[model samples]
Target chain A: MLVLSSPSGAGKSTIARNLLENDKGFELSVSVTTRPRRSSEIDGVHYHFRSRREFDNLRANDELLEWAEVHGNFYATPREPAERAMNEGRDMLFDIDWQGAEQLREKMQGDIVSVFILPPSMRELKVRLQRRAEDDAETISRRLANARNEIEHWRDYDYVVINRDLDRAYQQVLSIVAAERLRRDRSLGLFDYVTRLLDEQVD
Target chain B: MLVLSSPSGAGKSTIARNLLENDKGFELSVSVTTRPRRSSEIDGVHYHFRSRREFDNLRANDELLEWAEVHGNFYATPREPAERAMNEGRDMLFDIDWQGAEQLREKMQGDIVSVFILPPSMRELKVRLQRRAEDDAETISRRLANARNEIEHWRDYDYVVINRDLDRAYQQVLSIVAAERLRRDRSLGLFDYVTRLLDEQVD
Candidate 1:
């Protein structure tokens, strides 16, 4: 499992989108959220649009892998799909915050590879946010303030990529995924593979 | 520092050669050895051809970072070049056996990234050895016997690459180096970079 976390406008979503499109092996973990879905958003694709009550019930029942209340709306990752993905030996990608990442790490120690992305500069982050024009100046300022706090948790992550250039950062992220997959402990077939190697006769 | 180790015919040298040719940042740590130089070997390029007395004096004076006695010949990595390379923020590659790798790891715990290469099969390994025709039949048999013991040290490495295909294995090894360089602890500039980020004002 790969967990990617970043403050808004740090290019986490862009990296995730590139990985999903290029790397056929990764499946995104569709999160469930209580926020009202915009007309541009698809119910099951962008997020599993859920009522606040339903979201609470899932959280209370321990059916959610990780959940958090953000700006008065609840968001969570459902446990079932992620578990199924792992059991079937498929890699899942999570575009979550630090809290959710920490929860996933606690729940699946040694199975999670977490990366924190940072914008090259706070000025660049502000520029990116304003360029999107998705929110007002007040909201952008609020996010910028929150970004500092979010970056504090970067030390907790397994890898950190500074998004100075999109292509370079994307390549770095791809390298992390490739290297982690080849880790001896993560490659499940290696033991048997090595055993078969040992048994091969020399002529 | 990066250490690549494997049994004879496992392609550690091939992978190392590819890396050195392609990656400008890596410098090979030419080892001083008591073994006689082959006709094709250069005095200071392939190995630092040294007498047994010189090798012993270096070992006794703590001038070698890691040393091992293999097949009645002494091999040692000179401490100064490696330390200077690391201090200058350059990466050095060590094409050593498991014993030298273990010693380097002990001496430079966090700085060393060790990779163990494995051939696709024992039969393939034997074929590779035979194809090289560098050793006699008796020496080949002795190497084949030692290969099994060498492979037992696979679990001690940070990364393992199965040399099923040269290109694929090379890519994986390159990916490991790229990702390891981006690790939070290894990227020394990240802390100050992030600190400056936190101080930037939101407009």
Candidate 2:
């Protein structure tokens, strides 16, 4: 599984979307959130919109892999899909914050590869946020404040990509995933494959 | 620095050559060897030819990063060039065997990224060795015997690429290097970069 975490306006969502669209091998981990869905959002595609009670119940029962309170709303990753994906030899991608990423790392350990994306500069980050025009001045300021705290955890990640250029950042993320898959510990069939190779005739 | 290792016929050399030719960023770590230069080999380009006494003196002085007795000839990586490359923020590639890789790992630790290449099958490995026709039958047989020992060390590497196709293998190696360079620990300027980001105005 691959986990990507970045502060707001750092282009994690764009990179995640590009990976999902281009790489057929990856399945996005649809998060469960208590926040009200936007008009443009699909129930399952954007998030598994949950009632507060349901979110609490899932968290209490350990059915949620990770849960956090964000902007007064609860958000989480369901446990079942991610576990099933691993068992079935399928790859999963998690677009999450540092808290969610840390929780996943605690639970999944070596199974997860986490990357943190940094904006080119705070100036660029502010520009990107303003360009998106998704938030009012107060909300943007609040996000900017949170971004500093979020970036403090950059060293927690296995890899970091500076999102100076979206295309280059995306390519870096792609390369990390590709290389991680080839790691000796992750490639399950290697032992058997090597055994078969040893059995082959030299002549 | 990147180290690529494989048995004689597993195509590590080909991948290394391709990387050196295509990527100007990487410098090949030319090895000093006591082996007689082949008719086709250039002394400095292929291997730095050295007298047995010179090789022993270097090893005694710990001037060799890693060394091994192969086919009764001493082969070693010069310590100075690799140290200089790392100091200068330049990347070097080592086309060495598992023994050499392990020594580099022991000495450099996190500074080294090692990759192990595996031929698709033993049959393919033998075919490639025979096709090259560089060594006589006895020498080829010796290499085939040693291949099993080399394959056992695959788990020692950070990454493993099955050389099923040369182009694909080269691409994988390229991806590994690109991603490794962006690792939080390796990207030395990241601390200052992040610090500068923090100093920017929130508004």
Candidate 3:
């Protein structure tokens, strides 16, 4: 599991999109949510849109990896798909907040490699937020304020990438994924591999 | 600290050489030894030639990060150079054996990122040893046996790279280095940088 957290406008969504489009090896961990889906959103693709009762049951049964309540609607990462993907030897990418990241880490510490993307500076972050032009001035200001709260949690991540240059930051994330895949604890096939190597004949 | 360990002829030396030559950010942590230096080997560039008395003194005083006796001669990594490199914000590479790697990890658990390289197969390893033509058939056979002993310690490393293709293996190591550099604990400056970021004004 790969978790990426960033303050809004840090280019994390852009980086994560590039990774998934280019690397077919990863499957996105589609979250389950109680919020009603919009007309443009598709079920299971956008989110596993669940009823409030279903979301509550999933949480009660511990079927959710991590869950959050926002504005009285529930959002969660379903455990089944992520586990199945891992068992089938596929990597999973998660775009989650710091609190969700901590929960995932607690449940599955060894399998997860979390990265926090940082904007180059607060001023630059503000500039990017304003440039997006999708938000009102009040929402933009609120996001900037929330960015500091999120940025304070940067130290909790396994790796930190400063988005000074989008391409450079993306490449840094690629490196993290490649390197984590080589970790010995994660490579269970290595045992048989080394055994076969030692038993091989030499001329 | 970055340490690379592999059995002979597994392409570790070639990878380390290429990394040092291409990347100026790394400084080789040259080992100091009691063995007489070869005519072709420079004192500081290759190994720091030292007397047995001095080596013993350094080890006793905890001035050596790791020490071992090879063929009745003492070889050790000096603590000063490695620490100095870290203080200067430069990565230091150690081409050391498993025992040395263990010692380094014990001394500086948080700082060291060790990688173990494996030959593609035992048969391939034999071919590499024979191709080198540096030793007789008997010596090559003995080295092959020793390779298994060394390969068994692969679990001790944080990452493992199988040298199937030299370039790919090199890239994997490069990725490990890049990712490890971005580790939250290692980037000490991030704290102050984030502080400055939070305080910066946005208009």
How well is each residue in B56-125 modelled by candidate 2, as lDDT tens digits? 9998998999998877988899999999998999999999988999889898877888899999988888
Residue-wise lDDT of candidate 1 within A1-203, one digit each (tens)? 99999999999999999999999999999999999896778999889999988988898899999888877888899999999999999999999999899989998777889999999888999999999887889989888887888999999998999999999999999999999988888888888887877777784
In candidate 3, stretches whose alpha carbon ends up further than 4 angstroms from where it belongs are: A34-43, A48-63, A71-73, B33-44, B49-63, B71-74
lDDT assessment of candidate 1: 0.91
Give the CA lDDT, 0 to 100, for residue A112 in model 3. 86
Q: What share of the true interface contacts does each candidate keep?
A: 0.85, 0.85, 0.86
| Candidate 1 lDDT for residue A69 | 80
Per-residue lDDT of candidate 3, residues A1-203 (tens digit): 89999988999889988999999988888889998896767998878999999888998998999998744778789899888987887899998878789888988767888999999988889899999887789978888887888899998999999999999999999999999989988887998998887778774
- Superposing all C-alpha atoms, what RMSD in Å does each candidate have to the true structure? 1.6, 1.6, 2.8
Worst 10 residues of 2 chain B by lDDT: B194-203
Top DockQ model: 1
Error of 3 at A199 (Å): 2.2
Sort order, DockQ high to low = 1, 2, 3
Chain A TM-score values, per prediction: 0.96, 0.95, 0.87
lDDT of each: 0.91, 0.90, 0.88
Q: In candidate 1, which residue pairs get closer than 3 Å at backbone N, Cα or C atoms, i.e. clash?
A: none
Give chain B TM-scores in order: 0.95, 0.94, 0.86
